[model samples]
Target: MATELEECFHYFGYGNHLSNIHLHNKNALKVGIGKLVGYELHFGDFPASSSAKNCWKGGLASIQEKPGSVVWGVIWKMNQTDLEKLDRQVMGYRAKDVTVEKVDGGLISCRVYQLSEYIPAAPSTKYKRLMVDGAVENSLPNDYISKLVAIEDNGQTGAVDATLVDSEETKKTVTNGDGVHTSKAIHQSEGYFLYFAYGSNINSKRFSVSCPTSQKVAVGCLKEFCLEFAIKEQTSGEKFVGATIESRLNASTWGVVWRVDLTELPKLDRQEHIKEKFYEPVDVSVDLENGESVICRTYRVLQPYSPFPPSVLYKSVIVIGAEEHALPAAYIETLRSLPEGPEHTVGPMKSYYLEATKN
Candidate 1:
């Protein structure tokens, strides 16, 4: 933590890092809202941590000056340690000191980055969604978010290969209680399969019944997908509330990514009612909070509970998971504010939740 007078600097993040949900996962301590005066946010080729050339290349974001324009974002207070983490996060950009007018009517001297080399290109659709989500989460001007949504994919190929990745930032060196070194496994490795859980699975206690050791590894966002609770169960014909992502190019779904053992695949399928056709597996890629990409599998709705509200009991399960993993505050509020129906069919599922939360 930086004190009031010890060289604490305000760092403005207008892109994906602007979301406190994303930043806190990266160890950023947001101080307040900031408006970068006399500058505009633009996309171009620079640096990246993901291997998706088309999705990440020639369209990353940086700030450019527009005489009368301003970009809005979160003001983060950083000490030396936090500064080092950010340096690793923005490798190919040149940092410059800029005075940002604080939203609270104060002037803050902060550091903002500019691309070292600007290559005109369009950003990925997913990338655009990230910026829009961040802007909304940070309470930036609504017009700026509209502008981000309007950026179409330039579709220009030949994104110059990033020269800075495979650097120190990409490595995770950890040793455990057994003196065995284990960095996280990649998506769908021999023994693990990454599962994206946006609903009841968000609640670890409930998910544990399926995969006992299942743990959410990272917070991720999927573009153009919205969560809907219309999926109905085949056997019960009751609203056994759950979330299935629907495609909506202008929307996004936030969730937790979990690494499950391959052996548990059968069990998870049973729990999700693959036999009953409630949900079917869908392979997709999601962007992690650490600026990296992971290929994961998520379930999509195959049935409908049609014209019914979610039971508060089932909704609370997801709320617990989001809280357990620290999702974006705004997204959580959205979950909490959703309209719910009666605890209509409180059978084994409700008892299971009661026992799960008890232990």
Candidate 2:
């Protein structure tokens, strides 16, 4: 049966003219049955003509050739019943005389039978689809980050219940603590901090609720890291290089930092989904408003199969009602104008912007 199919292909100059062709359906039956449905063959870069159609009338079933291209494939929707009838009426041969078996979804096994003698053609250089990188640049808005933190701090099941303070002073300041101005000295002396995030947590309404006292800043940084994408038991898919940049204060880089009671650190860890096995807290240096630098803690993914490639995302969040300094614009620009990454890329995660350190 295979010999017959090969002869037909040679006579029709299929192997030489067609590019990549494959069967669309994978779950096709294997055994040679008496009657079954035909195959659907996909050919890329087919010529727009009916030349192959006029050549073989009996064997040819249907052909779909795109216009203005030199690529084509055939589908022979023949069943065992038709084959048996053709053997008795058209060709003086019994069904047992011809070898017929199910090869694959797109091909059928056949014995020697030729309409015309022709030379086998060489393989064609045509492809089905081109490869593309799914990378994009996304800047995180400050309001969105605040909302995310609020959602995270609040419960995921319900909408956040944040109220605007009614004090005139609170309305004027970006960092008023929900209209509660008890101690003027405490409000004046409290320093602000920043933290940067570049991941699924970019949905800031949730993150803000998680850190209600923190404000979303419009600063970012560019950095490279490795991560994977999976749900529970799926294996590795594709490796990518991700980028991120920190927002700047005076001449230094600033990130989102939270100024909370020391006891809230544990809650922050949980809200950030910081499992010991998957992520670890690390201290890094960032720039402040007056050219000074400060050390801040951030979380990094430590899982084995993370698909986070080298790409960039915003990561800085601001703290309201705090006295921390900020980094300069030059510093932020330096981080943004980094060179184009190597081949593979990933990510456009959210970033934080915070006040600079006091030194």
Candidate 3:
């Protein structure tokens, strides 16, 4: 009598998981070695839980495409049920398939896990040790092992690198796709987006009125940029300094990081008047106070105008947020000292948008 066979899944374990100990836990069948082309490795966004700090430090290991780059890892075969169980262990990561070249010179396709977005961050000493040990255990390459050792220095310096291959010597981070220092608009999955608010929107009460689903995540800092109130109301001439990212290496801007549900994105977009007229949505990758960086959607105006101080209500909203987030005390005082307004005009204008949502 003939017997039926169970369907199996194929994958390439590139990170610490390459250790046979982890594979045994997952009950995955270890195949042979495989080499992936046109991709490189980097430490991505922070790990799923802060409690796992000793494991990932700041970011988890991930792969991104880079011309003339390659990564070597163990190939494996696993049953469907086991694959599902393994997915739960790797939260905040998605598996994508790529064609790899086997050690025997055969090309085959396999799945690899990666973060939703690529962020430049350093990995923990423990995480790097696992990878280094796994690489030697699997005999990846002498140069590759050296590259893994250098990563320990990075975590100590708190500097991010473009790739883990060690040849590029990438000193600075490239936040946007165009490889230029300009405004960018980050797009996330349907459930949520990381929205960056540097103006009145930084205030939780005010921001919630426009986006009820918003949840404050962290206090963010953007490098090479400073706050400005260049845009003003055409009719009343009331000024409210929205966020404008100007190029000044020594300058920095503080803002709030909020997770806005995708369901409320449309309403918030319209409220911001993002019709390419005033305060258009932009994408930026900002570093948080906790030594992690993230991609967020922000706003900036297209036209440039002379600077003016923000109004009383406007400055008050910003100060309130700055204090609530416990941003540096000096920064909070700076916001309080900004020239405030004609309550006669600013009060009514603030009412138009600053009203709190009804409970």
For TM-score, the strongest prediction is: 1
**Candidate with better TM-score, 2 vs 3:** 3
TM-score of each: 0.49, 0.26, 0.45
Overall lDDT per candidate, in order of appearance: 0.67, 0.29, 0.64
Give one digit per residue, the lDDT tens place, for model 2 in 99-134. Answer: 222224343433222222122221111111000000
Off by over 4 Å in 3: 1-190, 233-243, 343-349, 352-359
Q: Candidate 1 — which residues are off by over 4 angstroms? A: 1-4, 20-26, 46-55, 82-85, 154-170, 173-359
Q: Whole-model lDDT, candidate 1?
A: 0.67
Residues 1-359 of candidate 3 have per-residue lDDT tens digits of: 43223466678888767663232233676778878899998786653452222224455778889999988888888776667666655656778888989988998778788776545677654456557656755667667666776774243311123233122112222233211122223243357878888877887888877888888889998765577775545334544445455433356788899988767776776666554244555556688988998978886653434565666667777788787788878778878778765454443336743553212
C-alpha RMSD by candidate, in order: 11.9, 25.8, 16.8
lDDT of 1 at 160: 23
- Candidate 3: give the clashing pairs: 184-282, 184-283, 185-282, 185-283, 229-241
C-alpha RMSD in Å of predicted model 1 compared with the true structure: 11.9
